[model samples]
Target: MKWGRKSMLVAAAAAMLATAACGSKAGDSGAPANEAGGAAKPGNAILATLGEGNDNLQGKKIALIMQFNEGAFSAQYVAGVKEQVESLGGTLQVQAAGNNLADMASKLDAAVNGGFDGILTDHGTAEALEAGVKKAVDKGIPVVAFDANLNVPGVTVLQQSDEEMSKQLLEKMKEDIGGKGNIVKVWVAGFAPMERRQISYKAFMDANPDIKEIAHFGTADKPALDTQNQMEAILKQYPNEGDISAVWASWDEFAKGATRAIQQAGRNEIKVYGIDMSDEDLQLIQDENSPWVASIAVDPKDIGRVQTRYLYQKLHGDQTDEKVVLEAVMVTRDALPKDKKINTTELGEYIEGWGKSEQGIADWMGRSDK
Candidate 1:
């Protein structure tokens, strides 16, 4: 993690307060420490002091810009951000780029011009946002990026540990397939997180020569339906137990399609391992007949809360790691809730630690202050 404390204006604008932000507290006998002074805490604990007593975040305007506004993941992520920002007494300014690169850039420019105190970019690539992010920084407006593969000098990049997630998913696939069989892969090129995961995929395949790729499927267009149709065709062509060992998908959407195809075709022998998850994913995995056995599930809401907290810290003059990669939890079919009453919005409630972050406490305390 690299830390680049920029202009004086940025430092002046920085602020922080947290009850349970991210990771454990630092500076105790048992807590770890480095030459720099404190060991980083996991989950939402901030061990180091970021210097308190700044103005509360109330009435501060924060802009959250995204490339797309659709999908379950997007909805949950937006919900998380809305909850955090509102709790922290900051007003949220939302912009949807509609998957247009130029529009994304324009929205960033708008946020800066509109004088938002902070900016958050979701799932954007460097090509689509570098200039705009640079502009925001130039204006002394701190910007935070979520899932954007950017190497910008001062922006904070928050993402999941994709390589480790990929490794776990692939290891599970290898176990199910006995380390050797015909496998299908669903992937896309150019997306940053997928690119990192692809590196792991390649390394895994190289180390295990026994696993052979019988077919290559890409999910660039009409993701779920396209993948489902393709998997159905493949299942028809190879209609034998153990003939197709497993299907590996880079994301849960592709995995959902593969699972559907397998279930429809009564291919009970095949299993799927995928990265990422949503409420729909949990529902499917809970099904006894689902081919999607496991996934590297992450709480999108938690991601939003964490990213928002990072912005809150930065706004309060708190020092943070340049890059924060959150670890993922392995979710399996058997571990899913037996009752199907839970709705998508309530999914986070079922998660181990969702809205109960130290950041939430900070927000409430700051608001209640006289």
Candidate 2:
């Protein structure tokens, strides 16, 4: 599912155009006056401008097409989108393609043909989604892509800064391993964010000669199995290589798979690190016998909310920056308070609430511009 070199070029160009055209002044209403002719404060003026725009989606319809809704992460994203769209007075129609590229294309066509006001998709591969995105754009539908590389023209991506996430994960790995280890990196294929993680990880490895990457491969859909298989094979090949200090995964599923393989083999010397703060992964981190030391958490609900706000602004003719990147922080089990425990449901709620907040939306829009 990897994009060919030509497709990559086209995607890059499309992304540049999409980002450049993100801003608009069409939706702005007259600024509110502060007592006759008094100048309005910056914050108040911003709020007034937003207020003047139509936030009601009472009759508007939104379509959300996911790469696949098989995992908790994808489910959380879809839930966030539905909740936010409803809160904004809109209806959300969701479709899952189960990782089938052709199915995604068909679903997107249906959404556009059905007159959905906006489309939200989880990008699986730049090339695979390109045709669908082009169709949506041709039909004047705005697209908000989540958790994938979106270099498509006229598309807005709602996801974390890939480079930043990778940097945080690598820094944490260095901290846990004391900057010395033979690491194996397993990444998600066809996902742009995971690709970026690999790029950043290579940079980190180059900077730290003490750390060596033994193997690097892609785990497209079955990330967990991919991780397990890759790790198992590596372990068998390097059965006596005691210097393997860590296993780095670009996603929690990969980390979990690696953990399972390592545990089965009774290798306690290897530490695991990854991104995506899934609840199950968090529990493992908290487990006394778990090998997971740290992870970078990007709240999917936050991503949904942010994308909604941006689409709202765009729909109403508001100016926005072309690319938005959110920050992620590394979480370590040792950093948790002694009395605190990981709560997956609570974390889900926290992200869900974000999708319902105007402020959250605004903040996300502001960040997206940069």
Candidate 3:
């Protein structure tokens, strides 16, 4: 994943078109923005689209505006978006909001007015995105939103089953801790998925009166590093065995941070459970004496691909659902492969119900876009 000089040049060239692409800082949204997952070259080199009716995506200019662009999950999701768009003969560029809500809102406005044929929005609040989404609808543009809390008509809202993800993670944590213990919660509010996941978190806290929350903390910016720093301090404060039972992370980044902090302190008694998983996460889970024990997540890449497919379907005048929720999967340390390292693609073999879904697939999509 090291970016050499050549890769940087390629990424810069690929992102040039997206300078004014989707989100706020990337263009004239009043702040400076950069492209997400711009470490690789774009796939506009060899573009082709084939199908019978309403399947033509070639030459379709697409924009992906993102408010959060960090971690392996986000990288894979961006990869999926880029790959799907390229496969279907469309061009895509990513615009980053740098975790700023106002910048994200401004990016939405830029995408609406930025001449993008289709738009893909990632992680913004309802208050900031509704008016801009409504504008896109008025202009007859198709939009596929990922974890953005917008109720605008004609905008396809896509996300993982947030409640289900939380439910599964919490259920496992409760079972592991015997339903009663002191635990820390790592989460941030305002993002659509985080908000929905909080629903179950709240319910879990209420339902389990014995499971007291010893500490609660999280942040959107540099989440893993920040969480590690904070967790280290928290560990010192509660410097005794059984003082903390487990750490429940709303996102994998937080889990990773807390895991490192816990492991470095040699707190083998403490465990970590989280939402979302990646190759790095899996590796950490399998690491000797690692504190990260379990996580629940949908395929991040599949989310992006499905989001792109929905956008293509909408642009083709096909009727689609207003809400699309991807299925979630739980991965525990016990379920991990013992002999080998498995990336996301090979995860389904070990974990049940962990593969791609046919949510936005259509007959017109065909086998190949060539």
RMSD of each: 12.7, 11.1, 8.5
In model 2, where is the ten-residue run with the lowest total lDDT?
Answer: 19-28
By the TM-score metric, which is better: model 1 or model 2?
Answer: 1
**What residue pairs clash in candidate 3, if any at all?**
23-107, 24-107, 25-33
Model 2 residue pairs with clashes: 15-151, 19-322, 23-320, 24-319, 27-317, 57-89, 321-369, 324-368
Q: Give per-model TM-scores.
A: 0.79, 0.76, 0.85
Segments of candidate 1 deviating more than 4 angstroms: 1-55, 337-370
- Angstrom error of the Cα, residue 204, model 3: value is 1.5
Which TM-score value belongs to model 3? 0.85
lDDT per residue as tens, model 3, 1-370? 0012322333232221110011112322322122444333322222223466645557788888776566777776777687778777788877766665677778878888988899998776677677888899899989889886678878888888889889889989999999999998887654567667879999989999999998877665456877798889889999999999999988888889899999999997899998887667888898758999998988776777789888988877898888998888889889987777777667777887665555677767754321
Of the pair 2 and 3, which is ahead by TM-score? Answer: 3
Error of 2 at 147 (Å): 3.9
Worst 10 residues of 1 by lDDT: 15-24
lDDT of each: 0.66, 0.60, 0.74
Cα lDDT of model 2 by residue, 1-370, tens digit: 1112332443343232111000001100111111111221111011112343354445577777655554444444444455455556676666765556676667777777887888877665566677878888887778777666657766777667778878888888888788787887765434567567768887887899988887765344455665676688788877864658888877777787788888888786788887776546767777767778787765554555566767766666555565777666667767654466644434433233212233335532322210
Best by TM-score: 3
